[model samples]
Structure formats: structure tokens, C-alpha cells
Target chain A: MNYPWPDIGTPLDQVATPMPVIDEDRLAANIARAQDYLDSHGKAFRPHIKTHKIAAIAHRQVEAGAIGINCQKVTEAEVFAAAGFDDILITYNILGAAKLARLKALNGRVPKLSVVADSETTVNGLDATFDADRPLTVLVECDTGGRRCGVQTPDAAAALAQRIAAAPGLRFAGLLTYPAAGGAAEVEAFIVGTMALLAEQGIDCPVRSNGGSPDLFSAHLVPSATEHRAGTYVYNDRSMVRAGHCTADDLAMHILATVVSRPAPDRAVLDCGSKALTSDLLGFTDYGAIEGYEGARIVSLSEEHAVVDLGGCAAGFPGIGAMVKVVPNHTCVVTNLFDRMVFHRDGIVTRVETVDARGTVW
Target chain B: MNYPWPDIGTPLDQVATPMPVIDEDRLAANIARAQDYLDSHGKAFRPHIKTHKIAAIAHRQVEAGAIGINCQKVTEAEVFAAAGFDDILITYNILGAAKLARLKALNGRVPKLSVVADSETTVNGLDATFDADRPLTVLVECDTGGRRCGVQTPDAAAALAQRIAAAPGLRFAGLLTYPAAGGAAEVEAFIVGTMALLAEQGIDCPVRSNGGSPDLFSAHLVPSATEHRAGTYVYNDRSMVRAGHCTADDLAMHILATVVSRPAPDRAVLDCGSKALTSDLLGFTDYGAIEGYEGARIVSLSEEHAVVDLGGCAAGFPGIGAMVKVVPNHTCVVTNLFDRMVFHRDGIVTRVETVDARGTVW
Candidate 1:
């Protein structure tokens, strides 16, 4: 498929509809704000690259004093590693022989590569893949009330760490948890307890990673975590705004779309739909929020059309051919949908970057 | 990003996890079934390419006796047209100058290219782009109880048809609609009224296109509709089965994923998540249905992890590293997420096809 990305100097109106755009000023501000906040709290910052999947954005984040980057998949980390990004942490359980072999290769390419494991099956796969010549760093993932991809208790986490320390080809690094929203207290308790248990077993725990965009500002509350990770902070979305983490002004990315059809006085359809703006409701009834159109709800979405209910709005409905900007419900999934994103400053196109790891889901 | 699509003849177990697999036997059977059903009703079958977006499958549909192809976007149509498809109908309102220029070029390439318009603004854009030397065929899009993008009334549809016929560079071909589910009676009434209005104005109405995968087998009920359009029938999904359009055995596409993490006794995480399997619930409580696991539910999804709750299941939970097949709630959105799809017959891989129009949203 051919993507007609606009040139560097093109204006936003002439670029195209149903295209993802990043505001350069807002993106820079977001990266700097998160880095400064984490730095003031004396925590290492590792921005997750799953949000943008662009090496340029990762470079910006690193330049803003991020300690490293966090990836979710082996193939996704391989893209950043090839682009000269070292000190990467993959916050996913690496299981199966095919993925373990690729993880070993990625570890060899980068200066420091680490992964998380919550079970003996995953740790065994990692231990069998690496050797003493180059040991792989493995972090024990604790539940911490997240109830997703983590051990139930701190005892299970410490047990996994002990097994990791005993393996010749693995190092028991520390504890990691992707906690539920507003669960910073539980996360700190889980990590602190696991660290105390590891100390009793004579295991040197180094990294304690905690992550969630919803509770990014509350990282200081979890004082035991040495490093903090976040992805959606770079692109504040409708979900973030609703969570009070960031206001609408801090949103860096917006889907530029055109009003292609207005079937009724109460309804208008945009060119962007599930293919451009994803179906991740993130608890919102609407797909996204349209800028300058308060009370307008994106009620439904087909493959390439978003139906907007214009009733109960103070503002008049946009006529056909008028362009509108939509702040997606979840910006990360929207980033994965497009091949390239147009970066702009003050409505002037700055650059167009290809999503390097757009479809590296495995 | 590098996608390690498996080689031909690779076993299903050898192929990478979190990859979309198409059962070739089921896919062929689906295409033949839809075509034969539509043929038996003496209605033309214009398969929508947005579901699969692969030229190979489109070729298969054409060979199975589809009259033409239906595309939702101009660039999407360009892909099938480049692959030797002559007759194409883009069922979208092609607005804006950038898209209209491309639409004119596409019309010049294909032998029979048509488009739908509901407003005078869209028709004027089309009329201004093309010349009378090579006129463009335009169909009036009627709402017909589907409140997405269409004229609200039959009178409005006939008015647009008259405007198209009066334009020097346009031809009022007929009427088109994407009706609501089980809206055959409403669709027939609307199209019949529009045709009568067009007949009173002495306008020639040759084509009446009615489409919806949920009402695929009921095409004969809408006797006025000359052709039928359905996309998901080619790859039946959970929603299709729930709608009683096809059985679960007719589902062709499945996400072959590996159990990556078994953190708890009653919970397991699959490698496929919102990025691989889409976040589109399609009114289902879970993301997808696990084959052979009757009571297991995919409770939640992250970007790269699907947390499955194995509670109350008659069958045992899948151990870590065990492979499972999942029928997605909606197959069309899943196809848009991946760069390539694997095809197999009887558990042996046959081919891998790149989604040609994967990110051609604009």
C-alpha cells in the first residue's frame, strides 16, 4: 500500500485526512516533563517504546535523560537495537524455544538486555538459551494487585529469583510489576517484601521496575522502585485526560480526519474509523474526542467510517469537507495502525517517520 | 521491522505464535458457499475486499463468480486494480481534492470503476475532477435504516441521482446501501421507492446494491437489489456465527497463539493481545473464543498479552508454551493488524500472503 505522506514543509490542512499527526512542541514537552519529574524523585526513567515505536521518538526520550527503553516483544526490541538503542528491558515473559533463541540474539547485539519471568517455565527457557559467557538478566514479576502476567505473592517472586540465581546462565536482577491503576502502595509493598526475601537468600537484586501511565505521577509513592516506566505519557490521550494525568492541551498526537458525510442534522461521519482510530474504548463510551466540538460523541465505527452524534452539542455540526482532529481513546493502538505519522509544529509539517515496529507483535 | 513468516510446508506448530492463520479448506468452502448462495438467488456478488485485503483471496472470489469487488477507500481500490481487477466499486464518499485526483486516476485505469455519493458536495467534487470524454459512474447512497453515511430519504437519493445525471462528467448508474442487520424489508422499501422516484424523472436505474454480512443468506428477500456485498462471509468470525450467518466450523481465520505465562492456577496469558488479536469486542464479553476450551474466558487484554481466566472450565488450563487457536470476535479488524497472514490446509502450511492494503486508510 502506498502512503502519500506530505513533505516536510507542507501545512496540516493540505497534508491529508485520517492521518496521525504528532505535535513537535507537545511531544518534546511531554518527554521533558516525565524525565524531569522522575529525575526529581531520584528514579531512573525508561520510556516504553510500544507507544510510538519510532526510533526518533526514543532518541528524543533518551536525550531527555531517560535511563533506557522498555519494549514488549523480542521483534520490537530488535528494531530499536538495530537502531542503536542499548539498555533495553522487555517487560514480557519470554516463553518457547523460537522466542528464546531470538531473545538470546538480541541480548548479544545490545550492551544490556533484560526480560521478566513469572514462572519456572519462562525462567527455564531463558536459562537454557543463554550461557555463562554472557548471562541473561531476569526480573521476577510480582502480581501487586494487577492480576495480570505476574506471580500471586512475594514468596513466589522470591522463589523464582532464587531459581534464577542458581542457574549458571541467568542473573536474578530484581522485581518488576505492572500494577493496576492507583495501586502504588500495593506495588511498593510487593517489591519491598520480595527484595527482603532475596537479601535473606544472599541474592543481589539491582533493578526494581514499576510501570503504568495512569499512575505515572505517583511513582514517588512507590519509593522502593528504582526505575519507572511509562508509554502513553508521551502521547496523552482521552483516557489520560479523563484520568487527570494530563489535560487536553498536553495531548501530543491527534488523528486528522475529514467530515465525509453528514446524513442527518444530528449525525456526521468522519473518514477515520476503527482502522485509523482503534476500538479500544478504555472505559469511554465514545471512540475518541473531537477537538473544538464539545458534547459530540463518536457513537460507532465501521472499518473506515466513524459515526459522530452531533446532537446535544453547543457547536454546529461540521459540514462535509471540513476537517476535524480526534484525540483517540488509546493512542498507542492508534500508532500501531498507521504506517507513518506526520510530525508538525504549529500546524506546519516537520517530518514523517515510519513506525519501525508497527506490526512486530510476536 | 522483520516479519518471520514461515516457509511453505512448515507445520502449524513450527510457525511463530501470535500469528493469523487461515484454514485454506474452510476459506475455499466459504467463498464457494457465498457465491453459490448468491448465484442461486440470481443476485450479483460483489465481495468487499476490506475483510481479507489480499489479492489472492480477491482472485479466488472472482474465480468463484463474483461480479466485481467493493473497496472502502480509494487507495484500497488501487491495490486490487493494480492486481488486474477490472470492475471495482468504491462504496465510500470520496471527498477532498487529494482523493478525487487519485479517484480520477483509478477510474482511468480500471475498465469499470464506480463510486457512491450522498451529498451534492461529494458529487460536485467528482464532477469537477473528471471530464465528459470519460465520465465516472456515480451511485446514490441511501440510508435505508443504517444511519452511517447515506441520504436520509428516497426523495433525497433521487435528487442526488438527478444531480449526477445532469452533470456532464457523471452517470447516475443506480442506488446503493449498507443496511442494518435484518433490515431486508426496510432496504427493499427504500430502494424500491428511490427507483420509482428515479423512474418518474425518466432516469435509468440499472443497479441496486444491498449489503450486510449478517443478512447474507437473506439476499433473496430484497428482490430489488441487483447485487449483494459481504466482506466477513469470506472469513466467518465469532460475531458472524452469533448472528447465525455461519456455523463455528465455517470460521476460516484463527489467531494461533502460545500460552506465554501461567501466573496463577486459574489464569494464563497468551502471546496474542490487542495488537495481534484486536480490541474489538463486537458486543462479546470476551475478546475471542478459545477453541476446545468451552468455559475459558479472555478476561482482559494488554498490548501484547491476553489474560485468560480458566475458572469454571471443564477442560484443564493450557500449560505454559502450549499452543491454542482463537477465533477472533471480528476477523476484519484482526486482518488489518498484521502485515502477513499464513494459509494452511489440514494443519499444514501452504502459503503466506501480505495484506496488500493493510494501512491504506487514506
Candidate 2:
């Protein structure tokens, strides 16, 4: 696509630098790379739509050979499923009556509807909402390393899988794992130990799904992994850079914000603040990644302005009328902040895509 | 206006309870109360549009005796100004070349255009952007206890005001203060002292703007104040409640979320998270105000779900299916996150007002 801001030029005195800017080139390449990996590995690449939360990106993934999209929330799945994606796997434990009702409703529209369950309560909630005829496929989540939510051990896993199989409105699929950072060994140990036990019990184990972007490369190390779902790899951000996955230039999303104020000698402000980049440092040292600028801490943030304190230490301030590029600590949350993001290429902003699920909130 | 969801009944099952909830009765009372105060006060009420950023609320404000609306960013002002609010005071220092081009364009459309300047660079940036025929009015920001911006002394204020008045594309309108919490005396001292110094310089100061919801009641103490602009009174969040300005029930904006997971005993996860509530604690202790549950420390927040640890919990959680309301810690940031917030009347969702100025990043 032809870019709109082709004439913007290279930093002619900062036009407006606080809002995020999306680098379309890196994003396309990342999607292609992930697709290539999926193709070679004989594994289904069901990318999670939560990271982008934009239907445009989802459509792009489907075009890039993604089997489907994985959603962290039922509401998110509802959003993507509504956006014409035929298949979606809800990765989180889908509990509660209202959510189950929504999930049961979602099953008819979506070609494939699968969910992960860790405990009996969640399965019970799912059972109450779903019908026996339209049984929901259950993936037993094993707590390999990352201890957010899952059955603690292989025995706990087997018990849950058994419960799922025995349940009227449920069908046990297989083991699932959201791998711990670099804990491929743990994932391997858990899946190997559990599947063998299940085989001894004469239970069939077909699907083995795992996800999370931090250790996307480690998926190959995880034996018996039938599929992998990752989100952040598509639009690598500052967090990805911090995680040693991508470079700052490789980042696809840039908050195209304006430097609104220069409050003091060494102080500059961007129209983008916590509302734009968000204070989700995501375990990073710096507030966000501003490609060229260094020694600038995004010290203060109101709803609209991000006050950058240069500490009177810059070689020279980028003048008051400068447009600055800011990489949010957490790109996904920042994307959620805005209703639409202006897509730019070759120094021009041409298309503005609506974050249709911008604030679905429920 | 009719409400959505349950009016009165047993709490929702499997829901993450004590989330952000809007109290309809108190919300109406807050609007009327703030409107009444602004109406009765001598100063013109240009209730800051940054609070809600909703045109419906702006329309409501216009209906409720607001002379104009004070918006911090150009896009925010554009929303109300485009909606036919003839007068608008964009309080932030609108810097940058492209933004200036946009601001210059805006100056022609809006009948009255005013902005703030706390630095010399900003004054000049404004000078470069505006036209000579219709110079933009500059409000010299005074450091009234909020040490973020503004001139330190009255002489400094007089000097900048004189410079702004002398600048080709700028005219010093008056003084502005976003005071520290309960810094009315500081506003009074700065105004009186600055006015005295300006008089010594034989300069006429036209606008004296004092703002802040925490210090809204004390605004009358600044006798020469021309206007008062406050945003947070629209949604009296947990921070406001802690500031003693509002009770918990006075909150308006609530996150309508469902419980997705019940991982363990005394732990449930709600759909609303940092992407919704935002990380702006505003110095208030708890994450966000959960009406009936005071002890529920919003222990964890991801992009999409708020993991509330009800371990040493007080009020029991609502059921999984319940749609609980959450009074966010900082309402302003919360407003910036979502595209639309469903207004409720008597617990029923009434209207889906567009956040017209949303994602107007640059």
C-alpha cells in the first residue's frame, strides 16, 4: 500500500512524537516468518489475537497460514470469532455461568471451539452453560513451570482429563501447557510423563497445545507439541526487545505522538502519556523505547501528556516542535487504549484501521 | 434512561467481585452537585472535557450551565469544538510543527481559542504556529504547589506574560494553575501575587484559571479567578473518595466485567484489567474502588484480566456469572482506555456514546 506520510521526511524538527507509530514492514515479515516456521514444523500455528486485538491483523494471520487464532478470554474469542475467523481456541480457564452462556453461544458460529481447564469448578461452570449435544472440547492445562493456573502435577492432570471425559457436556482433548520462560525441559517432562500415564490408562492423547511468546523458539524443544500459539511475535514491541527477540527497528508499532510541551530546559512532553504507551513497564527498566533518544525517563504521565525528563543531560533537546516516536512497554495495552491506529509506511500515514474490539471491556 | 443487567438479586456466581461499579444515584447526584457548584460560583464553568472525553457528557455539561469546555489536548478539544461548542480552552502547551499546523487550523474554527505556556520554548512554539491576524491567547501557568510546570515566582510570571503579549503570534490572556491536592491557598497566593506584579508592569491579565477536583470547593477562595475546569468530578473514582471529596457510591464509570477464572479458593479473575482501569493509582491505596469490598486489594493486573486476591478478604465475592461494577482508581485514565462506556440508569445500560476524540493521537 502507498503510504500517506511519504513527504514527512526524516525528523525535520519533531512533528508529533508521542502517539504510537506502526512499522508495517517488520510486522509483515514477522507474520511471514512465523508462518514459515509453522509450515516446516508440521504444526498448526494458531496465533493468539489478543496481542494485536485488531481484526485486520487477524485476517492477515489467517492469510499467512494460521490454522486459527487463540484467545485469552471468551470475550476476546467472541470478538475474533465475530470478525469471521472460523476457528478459535480459548486458552484460559473458561468458568462461570454468564461466560459459559457466551461460550456456548460462540460454539455454533465458530467452526472449532476449544478451551483449557485446570480445575473442577471451571469444568463445572462450563458443564452448566454447555449442552450435551454441543459438547465443548477440554484441554487439560498442566502446571509445568509457570504457576499462574493449572493442575499441579501429572496425576492432577489425569484426574481433570478423566473428569472432562466423564462429564456430560465435556470431551477431553489432550494436554496443554503455557510454557515457562526457557523451561522446555519442564514442558517436555510434564507432557512425556503425563501422556505415558494416560496411555497406560488406555486413554487416547491426540492434541498437545502450548503457547506464550517469550519462549517461542523453545516450542521445538517441547516434544509431542501438536500446535503452538504466540501473539507478540507478529508485532514485536519494546517488551520483545527486552526479551532479546527483536530489535528496536524491528518493532512494528510506534505510538506516533507529538511532543506537546517543553516544560523546562531539559524537559520535553509528548501528547502520548500513560494513556498512550501505558505504564506497563512489563518488567523493563526504561518506561518505553524511544529509538534515538537516550537518558530520558518518562517521569510523569497525565492522561494525555508524557513528560520526559532529560535530566539536563542531553547533548541537545530535540527542540519544542519535534515529533517523537515512542515504543510502549506493553504494546497490546497501548493498542487497547486507542480506537484506531494510523498505519504508515515510507514516512507517510495513509490508512487508519479501527481497533474494532478496542474496548470490548466485557 | 433504563438500566441494563440485574437490578437487585443474589450476587452473580463465579464472577470476580468488588470490581469497578457505577452507583447510578450518586452519579446523578455528583453531576448535579458539580454543576450546581460551578453554576453558583462567580467563575465560568468550562468543565474539563478530559474527564469523560464523551460528547454526550459534554452535551450534558452544555445543558447543565457550562459556558464552555476545557480540554487538555487538541484532538479532545476538536471533539467538543467540532460538536459546535463555540468556545474551548485547550489547556496543554500545544507544541510541534504538524500539531501547530493543526492547532492553527483549529484556531480559525473555534470562536475562542486559548492555551497554556509554562516555558519560553512553548511560548515561541505557539508563536510560530499561530497567525498574526488572530493570535492565540497564552495562559501563563503558575506553579501553584503542583511542581510539574509553571513559573516559580510572580516576577517570573509577569516577565513571561509580558513576553507572551509581545510575541508576534501570541497574546498573554492570563494565568492558569493545576494546583496540588487542596492547593487553593497556593492558587490564591500565586494569582494575587502575579496580578500585583502584572499591575506593576502595567499589563492587563484577563484570564485566571484555577482547576482540580480535589480542590474544587476551595476554588472560590481565588477571588479573581475567571474560570474553573475540573474533569474527575464526572466520575468520582476511588482516588476522589480517598481525597474525601466523594464517597464510593458517587462514582459513575464502572468496568462491566465477567469472571473468567476461579483458579483457587479466595481467588477469582475479572475480565477488566490494566487495559481498562489503567495503572494510574493517583496515590490512592487500593487498585480500584470495589463498593462493598474494601479489603479486596487488586493484587494483580494483566492486560485483560484483574486477578483479585481475596485471601484475607472481607466481603464475599459475587458468583461467577455476576456483572460487577468497578470504580477505577483514576477515572480519567480509564476513560482514555475505552472507545465507549455504556451509561446506566437504575442499573440498566442506557446508551453507547461514542468516544469521538478517541485515538486522535497526533
- Model 2 lDDT at residue A151: 76
Q: Write the per-residue lDDT of candidate 2 for residues A185-285, one digit (tens) a residue.
A: 88888888889888888788799887777767657777678888898887788888877877776788877655555556666667776766776756665
lDDT of model 1 at residue A354?
A: 88
Q: Report the number of backbone clashes for model 1.
A: 0
True contacts kept of each: 0.86, 0.47
- Regions of candidate 2 where Cα sits further than 4 Å from its true position: A1-17, A33-43, A95-102, A128-134, A167-169, A180-182, A345-351, B1-21, B35-41, B124-135, B167-171, B221-224, B284-286, B350-352
CA displacement after TM-score superposition, residue B83 of candidate 1 (Å): 0.9
Which regions of candidate 1 are displaced past 4 Å?
Answer: none
TM-score of each: 0.99, 0.88
Error of 2 at A309 (Å): 1.8
Worst 10 residues of 1 chain B by lDDT: B312-321
Q: Which ten residues in a row have the lowest lDDT in candidate 1 chain A?
A: A180-189
Residue B275 accuracy (lDDT) in model 2:
71
